[model samples]
Target: MKRTLVIGDIHGGFKALQQVFERANVTENDQLIFLGDYVDGWSESSQIIQFLIELSEKQECIFIKGNHDAFAEDWFSSRETPGVWLYNGGKKTVESYADYSPENLKLHLEFFQRMKNYYVDEENRLFIHAGYSSMHGPEREVYSSNYRWDRTLWETAVAMDKKLSRNSNLYPKRLLLYKEIFIGHTPTLHLGVKIPIMKANIWNLDTGAAFTGALSIMDVNTKEFWQSDPLPSLYPAERGRNK
Candidate 1:
């Protein structure tokens, strides 16, 4: 049967991305939903973008825009790199594109431009890079940046009382907007876990591949997931975003 797989932040660990895809045995029959952060951190940021471009040509893929991706997009469009972004792994992304031709850089920029801030599937499952704040749902969100930068939605879900029933008046209305929400901006490592986490109906897929953790991919239906080796093991000489 065809499966729908949700992937977490890549953070430029192309090797980890490759390993997870191989371990997951991904096929053309699978529908892939990437939760962004495709660039930044490791040394192969440009290569990762090229790979995803090629992958999309052969498979069904939905790309969500992450905060890091937004920053990279701004740099690619304006050639102005933010100091904070550079400190947070954007420098590697710039270096990775050093050898690219203007035409190629423009192509990559277009790829970034094509990414969606959020995607809601036929089953009402929300796939977003970070989170949204509006209780009415992402579509009604007034602050567009919230889609790629907000953590309140996840925080609300995580802090919510597990015993609270869906019908409870105190239950967050944001969680009630969708059947299930899948996000990746906040790595599970912050919560002291190295795997995908589920709190309430939200799934946090970022396993901190930007630091010492692994890249992850999960079957949205079964919740069965696969991961790559910790990124540091894949690129021992790289500090990634650990600095």
Candidate 2:
């Protein structure tokens, strides 16, 4: 059956991406929503972009920009490597594209440039690389780094989930903006789980592909998921400049 599939941060684990895609049986019929951070972690950051580009050519892919992706966009436009980006696994991403032709580089840049900050589907489900705090409207005021860097919103969701009085009056008003919200920036592995964490209608899909966990894909409608082999096992030899 066709469904809207949302994937968490890939960070550059091409093998993990492939495994999850295959496990989920992704096809052109599925609307694939990638919750960004496609680069900077595993060794094949450039290759992952190439794969996403190729996938976009055939499937209905909605790519949400991640904070790391924003940094990569900086390098794409200026070719300037900021110390922070380089320190946060950006060095591996740069090296991954070391020999690419200028034309291909431009194509890569174009891919990154076109990524959206957030996407609201027909179901009113919000897919964002990070959580949003905007109470203004459905269009959301999180057009800034909040779309890719905000952790406070997710933390609030966690807090709401922990509280027992989640009644109409007690539930967070912020989360009421969407039917459900899916995010990736803060990894669930940090919460002691290497799989998607669902709390108060907010699903955190990032399983720390940038570190020791696996990449994850979930059918947003059904809440069923598929995960790759533990990511570290995919590239046994290299740590991939993880941060």
Candidate 3:
């Protein structure tokens, strides 16, 4: 059977992305859901974006917009110079595209423009770049920014995992929205590791590929996972986020 692969934040690091793709053995038939943060960090953000664009043409790929990507959009639309985005490794992304022709620039910009805030599969599994609200059931209170900026949704899930007791049959209302929810943006390395973390029905997939961590991808339904070599090994001369 074909598989649905949910990938973590890339944060540039094209070499790391290549390694993970090889390890995962992804194919055109697979459904690939990228969590987000495709730009920033490392030095190959432009290349990575181009690779993804070509991949999307051949595969069932769902690209979710990330906060860093939002910053990139701002830069392009406003033709403004950098501020916080540069310090946050977005400089690398900008530098990567410094020499691109107008045609190439348009291609990359269109890809960003077409990205979605969140995605839900037929099985009701929610895929977002970051946290989301549970207060409103996809109606009024849902904020597009929540999909790229919030962390409480995942944080609460982690907390609930620790607080759940045998006597308690009730789960958090946020988790009730879907069978499973997958997200990226908050790297798992803050826990002193570089891997996907699971809490209740939520999965945190940003393994900090832009930092000292590795790129990760997993089968969303089966939970079979793959990772690249530690990012430092691939880009021996680069400094990651926390380096």
Estimate TM-scores for all models: 0.99, 0.95, 0.94
Determine the C-alpha RMSD for candidate 1 after optimal superposition of all C-alphas.
Answer: 0.6
Global local distance difference test of model 2: 0.87
Best-first order by lDDT: 1, 2, 3
Better of 1 and 2 by lDDT: 1
- Cα lDDT tens digits, model 1, 1-243, are 899999999999999999999999999999999999999999999999999999999999999999999999999999999999999999999999999999999999999999998999999999999898888999999999998999999899889888999999999999998899999999899999999999999999999999999999999999999999999999999999997
Better of 1 and 2 by TM-score: 1
- Per-candidate RMSD, Å: 0.6, 1.6, 1.9
Model 3 alpha-carbon drift over 4 Å, by segment: 137-139, 161-170
lDDT score of residue 232 within candidate 2: 84
What is each predicted model's overall lDDT from 0 to 1? 0.95, 0.87, 0.84
Candidate 3 lDDT (Cα, 0 to 1)? 0.84
RMSD of 2: 1.6
- Model 2 — which ten-residue stretch has the worst lDDT? 134-143
* Candidate 1 weakest lDDT stretch, 10 residues: 129-138
- Residue 115 lDDT, candidate 2, scale 0-100: 98
In model 3, the Cα lDDT at residue 222 comes to 80
Tens digits of per-residue lDDT for model 2, 1-243: 789999999888999999998999988999999999999978899999998899898979999999999999999999999998888889889999999999999999999999998898888888988876677633556458788888877898787646555467767777877788899999897789878998887899998888888899999888899999988899998785453
- Note the residue pairs that clash in candidate 3: none
- What does candidate 1 score on TM? 0.99
